[model samples]
Target: MTDYEKFKIRHNVITLGKKEYDIAIDKFVRKALKNKDVVSIYKIGSIRYPGLSDIDLIVFLKDRPKHFSIKKFSIKNLSAKEKYMFMHEIFAVPDSMGGKIKLLYPIFSLEHLGGKKYDFIEPETSDFIPFFIQEYVKGYMSWPDRIIRKGIIDEREIIPQVYATKYSIGIYQKILGYSSKEFERKCRQYIKVAENLREDFYKTKKDERDKIIIDLIYLTKEINNAMFFDLKKYLDKNIKTKPRTITLYLGFRPNIVVFNKHIDYMEFLNIRFLPSNFSLICKKDLSGAFNDEKLEKAFEKRYKLIEQYDDFIYKNNLGRFMMLTNMKSQFNITSFIKKRVSKN
Candidate 1:
């Protein structure tokens, strides 16, 4: 944690600048390694880019724990910041020597996918564009499509993860290289997104829908700038921004429709009344710029199946099953059962 101990990147190399984290990293890694349950430990996020006060650690269990607490809350003894970190269960990711996922710095337990599960981290780790393409196809495509079709477009947001197509295409080309099939598909996807944006834009008043439009514009630019060193070249020239020329007025939220909180056993789904937090998941801030509600809502319609899943979980005693198998927080019971039923 000291200055010299933190920045000395190598044993003897002087010019590598000030990355003195390996000792600290090894200490934690050794601790986890001592446990037979721990398969690997991953260092991710700010430490890889620059040294900082906090270090991120991802401990991948050989077998997941039934009750895995990445870290646990200590309201009784810990400081406020410590309590937050414990409750949220977050740590910085460390750097790797080098590899395909060298920059990714993921702690890989589900090793079959070669660091794929980490991709779900969102707007964090790395900007692998192909993943973004599919996510947008799923998330962005659904947003306007649902609200426009359902006549429910309002202050309520549809999806929380905001990304631009052009930048995704850009990163895909650079890191993963481009394929003709991939390129054509991205072009087609962007066209669909633009078409949706345009149709939705015109259908409603510019003033009323201004926040959504601005959200689209803002996230695109910010992600592009932060992710792309050559921002101009990677810009999504194909997806033109055609905001209406109406005078810029005070942008208001879409209609705030609170779900009836009084659930008689079954919870009626609606926007969570909590004020929006920008972190992707419960203060997992590495996910830069994303909020949680939209992402959760993006799948709310699908979660209608949760009723069946709830029955399924209780019938199978999934909470106990999860503990027995070390599934921990990683399992998605709803999606898991959906896949199982489809296969059967």
Candidate 2:
């Protein structure tokens, strides 16, 4: 490959940028490719969309390590300025990025891939991306509490399947443009139905609301069924090739921020009702029950801190103070200047 072709866009996708750290990923990926034992490397999480917090990944290796030792590779380090920013093997989901520079949590799996030490073999799987999508649905049904657990956040695991309809939207637009009469008609009908019913999902009964907890476990089975019927059909038909090891690099910066847009509820459709029959989406009951004492305490602590910060910023008229800048020094420039003048 020539130097000119190295950074060129392919298939309308851009994968290189001006930041030093963003460039470093290309270098790291290149090095990983040279390894004989590396089976595959998948780029996942916020990096796939806009407003990227960090480049998250999952590696499928010939052998899996017993424990993963990972490094924090921030494009711009915010440890001194942010709470819990430097936890070992933990990517503190930035409340807001300090700037546009991308962050790379450089291959957490690499941490445990010591010099020639190997453990379990990497599992063989056919539907890699589909597995990711289905897992989110299952977690919503089975382990909703873990989704909100404090500390290291995993966007790959938690981003609701409903948000991914945007991708389906993109694909349908392509189908429409192709002049496929039957397919386009069906696509338009499905989208219209989705738009109409997205607003009016039935409310949970009073008895269901007063349970020990109102996590999304109740909504999961619905999501999973949708995943099988609606999502599976769309994906299989569109992504109609055996997958390969891919390094997903969104060369341009995505414009969404985690702090500005934290997920309030799980998003998915009543796929049981088809495109042929438009139906409403299932949402989490917002009036939550915190039966776990530990989780309740944790929520209160985070809630109070955020509440105080919001009040501080509202009174000060300062910019939205991210968790990244919350703990940074608030030094008085006037006082320092006066002290310097006295010394002179």
lDDT scores of the candidates, listed in order? 0.31, 0.29
- What tens digits encode model 1's per-residue C-alpha lDDT throughout 1-344? 11222111111111111234444445445555565444445554333211112344554442233332323211234444333222223221211211223212122222221121333332332333322322322233333333333443223122112223554554445543544564456445654554465445335554444554444534443333333333223323322233321111111221121111122221111122222211011112112122334333322322232233334334433332221111111233235445655776
Q: Model 2 off-target regions past 4 Å?
A: 1-21, 27-50, 53-56, 64-137, 141-162, 165-344
Residue-level lDDT for 101 in candidate 1: 34
Positional deviation of residue 128's Cα in model 2 after best superposition, in angstroms: 9.8
- Highest TM-score among the candidates is held by which one? 1
Off by over 4 Å in 1: 1-19, 45-49, 52-56, 64-274, 277-344
Question: Whole-model lDDT, candidate 2?
Answer: 0.29
Per-residue accuracy of model 2 over 76-164 as CA lDDT, tens digit each: 33332221211112222211211111211111133322122223222112212222222223322223333323322232222223333
Cα displacement (angstroms), candidate 1, residue 325, comes to 20
Worst 10 residues of 1 by lDDT: 277-286
Find the number of clashing residue pairs for candidate 2. 6
TM-scores for every predicted model: 0.28, 0.23
